[model samples]
Structures are given as structure tokens and as C-alpha cells.
Target: MLKMMTYFQGFSGHQSVPVTVDFPRSPPKLPSTSEAESETSMSEASSEDLVPPLEAGAALYREEEKAAKKKEKKKSKGLASVFSVFTKGKKKKGQPSSAEPEGAAGSRQGLDGPLPTVEELKAALERGRLEAARPLLALERELAAAAAGGASAEELVRRQSKVEALYELLRDQVLGVLRRPLEAAPERLRQALAVVAEQEREDRQAAAAAGPGTSALATTRPRRWLQLWRCGVAEAAEERMGGRPAEGAEVPESVFLHMGRTMKEDLEAVVERLKPLFPAEFGVVAAYAESYHQHFAAHVAATAQFELCERDTYMLLVWVQNLYPNDILNSPKLAGELQGVGLGSLLPPKQIRLLEATFLSNEAANVKELMTRALELEAQRWAQDMPPQRLDGHCHSELAIDIIQIISQAQVKAESITLDLGSQIRQVLLVELLAFLRSYQHDFNEFLERGKKLRSYRANVIANINNCLSFRTSMEQNWQVPQDTLSLLLGPLAELKSHGFSTLLQSLCEDLKPLFKRFSHTRWAVPMETLEKIIATVGVRLPEFSELQDCFREELVEAVHLHLVKEYIIQLSKRRLVLKTAEQQQQLAGHILANADAIQHFCTEHGSHATWLQPALPTLAEIIRLQDPSAIKIEVATYATSYPDFSKGHLSAILAIKGNLSNSDVKSIRSILDVSTGVQEPSRPLFSLIKVG
Candidate 1:
């Protein structure tokens, strides 16, 4: 029959100095980085080496036990001395034990239980005697000698000899709790390392002071040993605690709290212990520190003990970077892990806003200087333009681009200070950029106000509005920072548009109002050529006003058309006194036809762009065409029938768009039309609407 084989995992005992390898027996090759390979090579030939593998020591102890058992079988009287302490499970003061806790048998090895208490096994581990289980192991083997005994005794022996989840859980669960105590609770693993690390620390002190003529290398040997011990401890302590915790196991709320006070203190203790071993071989220290983040940080997160927030993730990355600043690139695993912790994840915009704001709070003076520079650059350009008081599109356009480029989206020094700055450090520059945007909005607005007059209203205002919107669009694309972060800087440009839209329109109205009124109401009755002048001035101003057109909407542009045309029709209708002589009336007839055609062309062209202006079209068309009294009744009847609800007052107002229409003409036209005015009062139509009595 084949035997079931159990192979012990390889373990190397202590060496006061690092081991070197020579592959002369095999093919010549570059030396391996493996500690085990070097340790094995050193043990094979080095006569000065003292330590042995744990399994070897346990095997040697088993041989001694077998001899004792043989001696006990020859003289049965010695059984009391052997079995007395074993069965009694006596514990010395402060001496570690392997006794099981009461009712904790379920936690013992396999289905059956160990003879000693499990709590005692934990106590031995806490004391850092890596070989603490030897006594219990010996007793279990001695009691379970099945070759010399029967099936019942063998069953009893197997129950007592079985290994439990103790060592696996010690590495997986208990050790992790010590490292991240904020999100974990058990303290045994930390206490265990503290005991072992303290012993290693004392061993170094004695080794260093042993000889006066010790070489520098010899004196540092124990320190190097301590450093390696730290690596080993961190490795064992941070064994993967992945998957779900056993049912009913607690997973802490790490998201709600930002601080890791207990864990931080443990980290500091680790750093202090590892710090002394360095001036010699500090990469070991750095390797161990980064392992804290790589292994433990993930363990806690995977367990739902703590979430890796952006700030915490950034800090951990930086802390690990500092651990190996001079050689971080060489440690690719650490660098890769640091970069992956949260590097590529997109943060929510609101969180980014908070982060950016926090980052920029300290750079107030620099931010102000950038804003000043942007405004001064614009102010200088404005001075060189044709209309000095006129708003220059180029200047404001450059201003928006310059302000966003120089201040709100400055190139942050991310690479140079990788160790000094954390991930949240990105937020610092971002916040300042956003602050610059907010503070200088008023500055942009004031610059806008300074050049209120539009020299070429169509080309310049659109250029200005397009430039502002374009600047924002370009910043969003070109800025090296996150798109979400850069978008916050665009808020101020919208403010400029909101308030600046009204300002630009008001200035245009002030310039053109008198011209519009003269053309509409002049009693001298200007010629067809004069109507061209009105078409050129007001023609250029209406419809595609660049500022409004850039943010164009049907309802809004149509409303502008209505407002301009409403004034035109009302004032033009009031100019009835111009005609008296037959020669003058004939001359006025030509002028009125031209004015009506020009007005009709105006409404038709603009109404095309803003389709809502279409309903007002016919009203302006009829108003401008009304020249003779015979045509008046027909035009009035057409309007009343088109809008059957239009009242006599409304009919009179509609008839008043012609300057020649008088009270007698309007009264006779309405009477002929018989506008019922049944119930609906006269309300002006939207597109061709004119403010009238």
C-alpha cells in the first residue's frame, strides 16, 4: 500500500549576515534574488552556520521522543512523570500555554480537538516563539503511537494530533487586525510581532557590542537582520484576507470616517523599527512599507473594513513613494500598485470641486496676479481699437482664453513633487483655478461694460460671444487636467453672457431708436431712397445680432423682431399729416409704397429666421400697403376676418400702422368690416404686434 505524504513547507532559520550564492557546481549564471536559494547555498557548506529549518528541529525532537517512549515501555513506572504534566496541562506564571479555551472545541483542529487549549496556542504565538508548538506536537505524537497500539488508541491519537486553522488564521486574520486596527479588532498578531521584533532588536544590540575590533559590516549585520525580519513580519502579517469574512464576522464602516488613528500609530511604530536598519540596506525597509499598502490596504478594502477614498488613496501612494524615493522605479511592483490604487478612476464632479477648492486655497496672491494680467492684456487691446469705448470682440475673446489658460488651468507641477505632494495635491491647483474663474467674472463683466458700444454690431458681438464660448470649449479639450475639473472654470463666462446680453442690446437700442422713430413718423415723407438708409442701418442691426444668434432660440429672436417692428409700424402709422396737395399726395404715394415694401421685406427676412415671427407677417404687410381710403376698408376687413376676434379698438390700432389713415377712414373701415367684438377684447398678435392706444 502507498503511504499518504505530507511535505513541510520550506523554512530558513536565522543568519546574522546576508547569504551569497556561487553556481560553480551548475552552469555559470547571474545570481538569483531569492533569499531561500542563497540560504540553502549557505547552509550546504558554511561550517559557521548555526540555525536549522523548523521541520528539521521538530524531526530531531521526534527522535528524542521516540527514545523516551522506548525507555518508558521498558520501565512502566516512568509513565506518571511523562503523562503527569501532559494530562495536567500545567501553566507556569507568564509562561505561554497550548490549552484550549472552554467550549471553544469547535475552533480546534478538524472535527476532533487538540489535547491542549487553543487559547494557550494563541498565547504561545503572541510570545513570538516561532517554535512554540513543539511540546504539544511531541505529546500528541507520543500519545498517538498507533504501530505499538490499537485502533481506539490510534483514533484518540489522531484527534489530539490534528492541526487546526490556528496558523492559517493567525496569518490571515489576526496579523491583519494589528496592522489596520481602525477597521479591524484582534490584537494578537501585533503583540506577536512586537514580541518577536523585540527579541531580534536585542539580539542585534548584543551582536554589535560583542567585539571592539568589529568591521563596519560586522556591526551592521544584526541591523540588516532586523530589517529582513520586518519584511518577513509584514509578509506574514498581511497575508491575503480576501473573499467574504466568515458569516456573522463584522466588517467595519470605513467610508464614514476619514481618519485611521490606530493604524497610523502602528505604521509609525513599524517605520521607527525599520528606520535603524537602513543607512545600510534600506530597500528592504521600503519594500516592507510598500507591502503595507499593497497587501494590507487591499485586504481592508476587500473586507469592507475601509474604502479607499481619493484622499487616502493619494496619501498612501505618496507615502510609499517616499519610502523608496531614490529607487522607486526599480521597485516596479510597488510603483505599479501605487499607481493602480485609484489613479485612473474618475471622481464625481462635486467631489472634484471640493478637492480642487481645497488644493488652491493657499495660492491667493498668484491667482490674483494671473487675473490682473488677463484683464490688463484686454484693457491694452481695447485702447488700440477704432472705437476706444466700443467693446472689441478680439480683446474679450483673448481675455476669456487668457484667464482660463493662465489661472484656472495652470500646469500643476505633478511629477517633480511626487513624493512631497499627494493625490489630493491635484485638487489644490484646481481649486485655485476655479477660484480665479469666480473672482475674475466681475472683472470680465466690467471689461465688457467698458466697451458697451458696438461698432459693427453683427461681426463683433458674435465674435465676442463665440470667443467666450469657444474659449470654454477649447479649455475643456486642451487642458491636461481632468475634463470635469476644467469644466468648473466655465461658470464665469456664462455670467458674462447673462448680464452682458442685456447690456449689448440696450446700447444698440439707444443708437438706433432715433433713426427708427424718424423713419417711422417723419411728416416730410422721405423718398424710396431714404427707405434704403433705414434698411441699411436697422437692417444690419436686426435678425442675426451675433450675441443673440450664438445662443439662438426661435422664441427669443422672434421676440426681438416683434419689438423692433412694433415700433416701426406704430410710428410709421402716426405720420398722417404729411399729405395735403394733390402733387404732394402723389409724391407721398410713391414714398409710402417704398416704405411698405421695405417694411415688408424687413419682416419677411427676419421672420424667416425666427419662424414664430410668421404670424405677425401679414399685419405688417397690410399696414405698410395701406395708402388710399378705398384700400383701407378692404385691408381692415381682411385683418378682422383673419383674426375674427379682433375688436373695433384693435381694428383701429391695426389700421394706424399707415401714417395716412385718419379717424374718419379708421371709423368707416371698422363699420364696413362689422367686427363683432362679441365677447373677446382686443389683444395684440405676437409677431406683428405694435404698442398702440
Candidate 2:
């Protein structure tokens, strides 16, 4: 782990100290970062540390019970005979106590013997004879009460000096044991806690005996020992943080990871080994948990002030926001241990949000950089005129595969950290991807327009179309993307795909140009071979389209179908025609129907799924063929009903093609189409592309 400035020090045990944590204002720059090897070793140690052996815990508990019994027995037999009257019974009025036994009056000074040494007091506390230390506690209280009663200050100081020094030494020992429970004996902790409890009781009694307005000394003795106890627990937590990750060291692991493991193990020990030693009012478990939590949060904030790599940042975020609560604090071993405890986040909400935003921003930037590089590489390949790679006889580009890998890998990695995070990361990637797609579309369109003379032009165009189609399909399947983002992504891809299809179709249409020119009302006045030629020219190019993906192949075929029908309609509508008789109208209508059948058969045989478009041309030819004015009007209205995009210009062109319809009759039929309502628009409209005069 990398270490930084030391923090969370010098906490006071008697009062709560607020831990101040400052976060870095800016996010760390994105770099490929590696995890430290120490984390593995720490984790290995933690697994064994989390649960102490049942036999060991039970034995320790038994030993504590035995020591406590011994202490009680010794107090009853040894100290009780000497100090029992002082604590329990009322002193006799004007009479020596009988418990002092029948002896020489000169021997009655045993209680007045030399005050106990610090070593003796410590040894007694160690042996759990807390009663042996009670005399000193009484003396300290007596000196305070005397001072309050206006005793000479010098006399009070002379009397309290040695006793106060020994008691202070005892207080330090108790706090020392608390400061390092992992290394201290369970007996030591029990005795220390008992000493505090005894002092509290003695102080309360002294206060009662002195009464109000006489001696505030008992209440005002500062209770400094309790304050030192709190400071000790906080120091214990700080020590467990593994101390400043060896200054100048490269953080091979997440600092928080190591810190979390140490905290968890120690807290487990506190619950299992130390909780029973303290009074319930002391909240031993909660005290340690809060200290550990506060220190952990402060350390993390300090670490955040440094530049953390992506892996470390994510690890840090996960531990604070997810792992600490779920794995460490509420672990099965410590279940129900912290309920109702007002535990807070390891990092405040604001810091967590900033961390998350930084991660997302870095990821988005990385995606953009990768996408840009991919395009640049592809452009280099294009400049060098490398032929497109083919997959199963279809032109192929690695652009889609590479770009998809980038986005998907980021998503999976983000999800590995957290689910809610995955969605956020994906959104930023999508935003970058949207911009990348636009660039792709522009590049592809430019290639199609100007790279026609290049050897790989046709194949590159097809491959790019395949890429767009692939991108669109992936977005549709990705559940993490919001609907609006998905819609935004699909726009450029759809345009690119349509443009590619048209580019391919225009090449085919170019070959069919001569055949379309041969189409005319005059030419149809005789039997013609134009329809056969137009179908043959397109049928040859239809096989080239099979190289597309199944979805794209079908779409391209449908586009081809629509284009053919629209072009055929244009030829008919603009052709020189004057069929003034019913016989001539029937002849022209028959030719139109034959052309419709040819185009429809060519499209279907080529795997077009646009069956909706097959009826478009045939229905128009039927209107041209009908002679009954009412029948003609019905057919025109039917056409409009089926294709809402069927406009007035289309209807006028059809009637003109009939040639026998008078101006008044044309106007009357047009009204039928105009009045038609409730027409459902076709999903792929064809007539909307046709322009007629």
C-alpha cells in the first residue's frame, strides 16, 4: 500500500473529536494501474483472523472466569478483613472495632503502615485484587474533601503527593492495557475495568457524604482516567492502519484494503475477547467500531488527496461503500453486532459521488481515445489501399469488433465493481460512442462518394455498412443503455447503413439507366424488351448483396425493391403518352402490369422481406387498366388508403397514364383519394419517393 501524511492522531478518550477529511478537488488522471501483491498476503491472513477458534475463545473465557473467582476469594479472605469495615459496616461510637481483634493498642496502626508502592498496587491490580487498590482511591478522595473543607493547601499537597503519584501510575497502566487489547492479557483488561468501576462508586459515595455546597471535589476530580480511556481506543484503531505504507513506496495494493482487513480482524477480537471485560454502559464493541470507522474514513480521505490509479480508486470505493458494511461490519460472525448503532459512510456522500463521477469521466475519456485510435488505424489501412478482409465470402472490418470489445469490457469491469455503477459507466461510453459513430458515418460516406476509383472501394463500403448494422444490433440488445441514448446512437448508424445501401443500389441503378431510358409510352405502343433488360441488370447485382448480414441483406433487398418500383413509376409518369381510346389504355395498362410482375418477382427471388411493397406498383397499374369511371375512382381511393404517402401528384400521374381519362374525370377521381381517411401509414413507404407532374 502507498502511504501518505499521518492523520487521525491525538484523539481524546474523554471527549469526541471530529475527524477532518479533505478530498482531492480533481480526479486522478487515467492510467493502467496494477494491484499490489501485499493485498493477497493480507487477505490470506484475514481469512484466519476473522473467526478465532471456538476452543481458544471458550478457553480464554474459562480462564477469565477462574481468575475472577480467585480475585473474589482473595478479597474476601485477605483484603476484606483489613478494609471491610471501611467499606461495609458502620463504625462503632467511641469504641475500637472488634474486627481489629484483642491486641496491644500499639499494633492498631496496621492501616497506617507505609502507603503501598506503585509496584505493589500494579501487582495487586494484575492479580485482580482490585480491593487492594481501594485504600489509595479512598485517600485521594479524602484529600479532595479536606481541601474543599478549607484545609490548608500545603497540608493537602503534602498528604496527597505520594498517593496521587501511585494512583496516576495505576491509571496509566489501565489505559495502556486498553490501548492494545490484542497484545494485553484478558485479566489485565478485567482488572482495569474493575478499577474504573470502583472509583466511580467511591466518588459517588464521597459526593453523597460531603453533600451539596460542602465538597464539589468528588464530582470535580476531572474523571481524566475515562478521557484517557477513549484516547487509548482511538490510538488502537490508528495503529491497526499499518502505519503510513512505508513512505515513498509505490502503493502495490489499495491502502484501504489493507486497512479494512486489519480493522475487521481487530474489531472481531474486541467483540469476542474484550467486550465482556467492560461494563455494558461503556459500549465496548460500539466504541471500538466507531473508532475504527472514523480512522478508516479519515485515512481514505487522506489517500484520496493523492493521485490514485483507476484500480485503486475502484477498490477504495468498493470497500467504503459496499464491502465494509456487507463483508466486515455486518459479517456473519458479527451479525446483529452493530444494529441501531448510528454508523455512517466511510466517506461522506459528497466524496463518494465525486469518486464515482471521476471514474465515469475517466472511462468515457478512455473510450473516446480508443475509438479515435481505431478510426485512425482504419484510415491508415484505407490510405494504404488494403483490401477488406472477407468473412465467409462477405467483406469484413475489425472496426466494429474492436469498438464493441472496448465498450463491453468497460461495462463488465464496472459491473464487477457495482451494478448501479455499470449503468452510469455505460451511459458515458454511449455518449462517446455516439460521437464516434458520427465520425464513422462521415468517414464511410466520404469513402463511398470519392473512393469509387480505389480497388477496395466497393468492399470497404459494404464492410462499413456491416459495421453500422452490427453497432445498431448491439445497442438494441444492451439493457444498460437508456432508451434515449439508444435512440441517439441508432440515428447515425441508421443513416450510415441507409447511405451504404443506396450507394450499392446506385451502382446497380447506373447499369439500369440505359434500360430505363428505353421505357416510353411510344415504345410501349409496340412489344418491348426493356423490362427484361432492367430485371437482368438488377438480378446480377442481387447476388453481391447476399454478402451482407442476414438482417442487413434483407433490408438492402427491400431498399432495392422500393427503388425499382419508384423508378419504374417515374419512367411511366414522365413518358410521352396519349392513349385516348379504351383499347389503347388497356394495352398500356397491360404493359404496366407486366413490368410490375417482373420487378416484384426479381425482388422476392432475391430475398426481400418487403412484401408490403409488392402491391404498390400492381395497384397503380390496376387503376390505369380500369375503364368504368366509378371503378377507376374506387381503385384510386384504395391505393391512397393503403399508402398514406400516396399524394395528389401520384394520382394525377396515374390518370394521365390511362390517357383515356378526361380532365373532368381525372379531377373527380382525384377527389376520391383526397377524401380517403384513416389510412395506416406503411412502415416502409414507397410512393413517397416518387415525384410526378
**Highest lDDT: which candidate?**
2
Would you list the C-alpha lDDT of every candidate in the order shown? 0.42, 0.65
Q: Which digits, one per residue and each the tens of the lDDT, describe model 1 over residues 1-693?
A: 112111111111212132111101111111222334334433443432322222222234346555655544553333323233322235334333333332232222321123434333433333232333333333433433442355464344223322222232123222233233222212333333433343344345446546544121112123233344445444433442222234654424232111122222233433444334333322433544455445544543343224545344333332233222322322332344334333221233354344344333433445557667766665455544532222432223455656555543333322222523434444554666567656556655665656555454333344445555665666666555665666566767666555545554565567657766665455545545555665576556654453333343232344445555555555545535444344544454556555655555665555436443343435544444556777766666665555555556555654544446567876777796564445344453632344445
Global Cα RMSD, each model: 19.8, 13.2
Kindly list the per-residue Cα lDDT of model 2 for residues 460-484, writing each as its tens digit. Answer: 8788888876677777876446688
Candidate 1 has an lDDT of 0.42
Number of the predicted model whose TM-score against the real structure is largest: 2
TM-score of 2: 0.74
